[model samples]
Target: MTKIANVRCQLVDLEPETARSDASQSFVKQETVLVTVETVDGMSGTGYSYTIGTGGTAVVAMLRDHLVDGLLGADARNVEQIWQRMVTGTRATTVGAITSLAMAAIDVALWDLRGQRADEPVWRLAGGAHDRLPLYDTEGGWIHLTCEELVRNALAAKAAGVRGVKVKVGKPSLTEDAERLAAVRDAVGPAFEIMVDANQCFTGAEAARRAHSYESLGIAWFEEPLPADDLAGHVRLAAATTVPIAVGESLYSSLRFAEYVAAGAAGIVQVDAARVGGITPWLKVAHTAESFNVPVAPHFLMELHASLACAVPNGMYVEHIPQLGAISRGGHVIEEGWIRPPESPGIGIDWDLDAIDNLRVA
Candidate 1:
């Protein structure tokens, strides 16, 4: 039986090439926790998870000092058991970010090892529902962009054959946000989709007000319209507007997602694999959404999400934010607004290890 022989975790800090901003948060840099798991038979798999800009070291330290020790002598293929062990071991922090992020890094590495052993890609192993997924561009729609810039970028994306572009909402004036969306819609025409994200910047009343105006512009969905924990607010927002209320990236647990799904609070579930504790739980959340007939449009980590999005039938649009451009070894394919899952065995991220080593800060 293959057994986990060693585990290592390190921190890497990657700066964005351009400034990114939403209503509530600004894009500074991304801090990822890289994890490597080696089996006794001399095979190794790599996986990682991230924070938008901070807490990388805490995740790495949790993996190195606490979570890694728990896996010694355990069957490397027993992903579920290992995930539960990590969850139970870190009971104090299980519902929090640091613990979930640490567990995600390890869980992902374990899945990579499993896929490598089978000589199959994770998408196939997980259940290949589709080989190609539609892409949506978020990089071009940051809150700081002028209305002209927004229209220019949306038109550019349309020219490139992308299906949609996500615009940041929550400008000081609702009229400004509306005008921007109006310009983009008029530029891209009726065929192109425009998604709006508020990044949890609104209260129930405010989100309702904006959602009403957004619906008139034919937005595809209203993302993070209300705070993630405000399930009632989401329900109200979902009811008040015909626009789909998309949420999930800010949520930390499958149970939390279950609550949202059960309440019919969200129409699109934006499950982030890193935030949801890796591929195992991410799939659980995805399937959970499927059970409720809600579509999953996952948050960042495009390189990895492209595979997961293809693996499930309920998976929808994959957010296109090239955060790993500098560190990714570049094997996945994108053609005419569609992403083809990597054929490589495992999660398909070919990290430049040397670059990662150089970027490690802790």
Candidate 2:
């Protein structure tokens, strides 16, 4: 094997002009860390890890001070060792969230390099992957959206061939939440898959009450009904209501995933591509959830997950918000409710460096 050669990282500030809203928060900006790793063989790979908006600086710092230092001269093929070493650094500061975002950026690049080396796509390398992955539109719903507007997006999703549609809930009280779900339910009807996300904006009891109310509407699942770290609350909501809870995007660790799995707190696992350290731990989590018979439905960065979802048998659905289309050189195309996974090697989604650079604020 060629000696591991050079590694570099960059922090990018990509903010949207207008804030896009969801149930719990508004996305006023986006922050991404792009990691590029090069090898002595002249083989190079690209990766992306995300903090979304505010944590880009911290993530960039970890790479400059710790992550890149650890990777220098390390065997590029020893992906596991590199990953473990990064994890070790976690004992002190625990890259849990910060480092994983960094790890993901690097890991994805490495995987892309691997695929290019073999002249094969990532989905093929991961295993025998399907050509398409089912998708559900997240609709980018905000708190200000009227019930009718929420329903309109749901209809749009159905018209787009999306088999499933997810909407925002948690409107300050259970009564309002129920009313919103009711509107979305009526708009889309009983056959179309409907899911609601609280964005972890409610108390355990509030989550439970909302869950109970939506049960009659046949909601597929309740997402992040309680705060991400509220393990006991997760358990409470899972137990108290007939609706199963879904979470993991804001969740930071495999051990935490184990916590939710063991407690039977979450039924649907929504892992993020960049959040859990690129494809490595992301795949690990999918495999882990499979053991518990839980369905894996990934969160944002749908571009990256499109291939991943097809490669894994347990993948349930991909959430589509459509804003990233402007940034991604050639964004994933949504066709008849299924995304045609990128045929390019590695994660397959093109980063559009110029676009990324053009959007850089700092």
Candidate 3:
């Protein structure tokens, strides 16, 4: 048995090349909490989770003062056992972000260690359902961009062989959102898919109103229109429109997603691995969606999410938002529109330790 010998955490502040803005908030920077786990067998694995800007220090503290201690001396290959131990040990914070993110970092590292020991990539280890997944671009579709900007970016993604572009909605008027989407649709033509994201900026009533207008433009899905907690609201909104309702990023547990799925509220499950208590629950949620015959197009951390996405049969698209480009030594291969999973064992993030070390805050 490979015994875990050590666990470490670091806080790094990463600024986006361009600020990202959606209807509800602006991401001026990201604070990533990077975690590393080493086993007695001379093998180590790295994993990470992040906050938009704040609360990273709390995640760092949680890892150092709390989660890390529990992990030391455990069997590195017993991922599920370790995961449950971490979750139950932190029962007080179980339903919140800090506990979930902390668990995610450690749980992912455990999985990474498992993959490395077996000399297999995480996708195959997790369950290889597909070799590649189609890409969707969200970089150029932020709410701050103008119609002309939207068209230019959407066409660029299409030219790059991306299957679709997700434009941020929640403009002052439904007409305004429709006009911008229309501009993108007209620019890309009917061949390229157009999705819309509101980032939880709408009420159930407002979401339903906008969903109708979006449907007229042939949107692929209406994402996070209502807040993540409003399962009944989402169900009402879903019944009111033909466009699929996508959620799960803000949700912190697998049971929450099961509730959403069981209610027939979420049509596309965008389970963010970090937010859902790491790969263990992420897998549970993905399979949960599969049982319901719903497609999963998980949230960010594209590098790692690509592997997870390709692992499950119902996995659909991996959001092509490259947040780790500045700190990572390498990136994923996007050939024609689909992303090919990294052949390297474990999660594919190749940290330039020098760069990451320079930005380390804890």
Candidate 4:
């Protein structure tokens, strides 16, 4: 048997290329909790999860203090069994963010090992629904950028063959949001897609007003207009608007996704693998969204989400945020306007071990 031999976890902080923000909060940095699992025979794989700017040490603590011990000597191939064990063992925190993020690191490492053992890339190992996915730029759309900056970024992305760009909304006034969207729409023109995200900073009534105003500009969707937990409010907003209501980045479990889908509260499902626990539940959420005919445009962690977007049929677009550059070599290859997953065995990221060591804090 390929038995598990050891598990190791560490924390690394990476600065963003530029200041990032949305309606709800500012982007300070990314605190990443990385995990590596090695089998008795010496084969190994690595996986990771992240916090926007905090909680990485806690995730590492959860692994080192509460989770990693159970993984020792466990069957490396029994991914589902081991995932359940971790979930049940942390029953009190099972469906919460820190626990989910902690489990995600370990769970993803197991999937990586599974892929390496089978000599397949994770996208194919998971589902192989498609080989490539359309790319959309979100890095240029921070709420703090001026209208001219937004136009410049969108134009640059278009010139580079990117299919679309997401613009952050939720300024003090709906008029300000309208002006920003209009400037980008007028610049990018009608053919290039434009998505607007409020970052969950509006009430149901305010979101409806903005949705009506943005409809004229031809936005692809209105993302996170209301808070993630407001199921009833989202349902009301969905019914009131012609534009699709995109949600799920804040959600921590597949069950939460099911609740939203069954209630007709979500028009687009934005599952983040790290937030949902791991690739195991990430796939579950995607498939669940598919069952309801809801499409997926996962939130961030572009390096990881690229493979995941290709793994499922319902995956609509992969948001381009590019947060892995500081600790990794190479990147997603964008051909024409679409991004392709790495064909390498296992999860496929080329980690720069020296850089990781340099940044390691825990």
Of 1 and 4, the candidate ranking higher by lDDT: 4
Model 1, 206-311: lDDT tens digits are 8888888987788999999877899888887787789998999999999999999999898999999899899999999999999999999999989889989899
User: Local distance difference test, per candidate?
Assistant: 0.90, 0.78, 0.90, 0.92
Model 2 lDDT per residue over 1-362, tens place? 54468887776666654456766567756787778788888888888766645788888887888778777788787676778877887677654788778777878887887787788788778864467878887753556788888888888878888888777776777778778878888888899988888888887666766777888999898988888988888887788888878999987777778888989998999988788777878888888888999998898777778778777778888877554555577636667888877777766767777887786643
Per-residue lDDT value at 135 in model 1:
98
Model 3 residue 122 distance off true place after TM-score fit, in angstroms: 0.3
What TM-score, computed on C-alpha atoms, does each candidate reach? 0.99, 0.94, 0.98, 0.99
Q: Could you list the CA RMSD of all candidates, in the order they appear?
A: 0.9, 1.9, 0.9, 0.9
Instruction: List the lowest-lDDT window of 10 residues for candidate 4.
Output: 329-338
lDDT for 355 in candidate 1 is 91
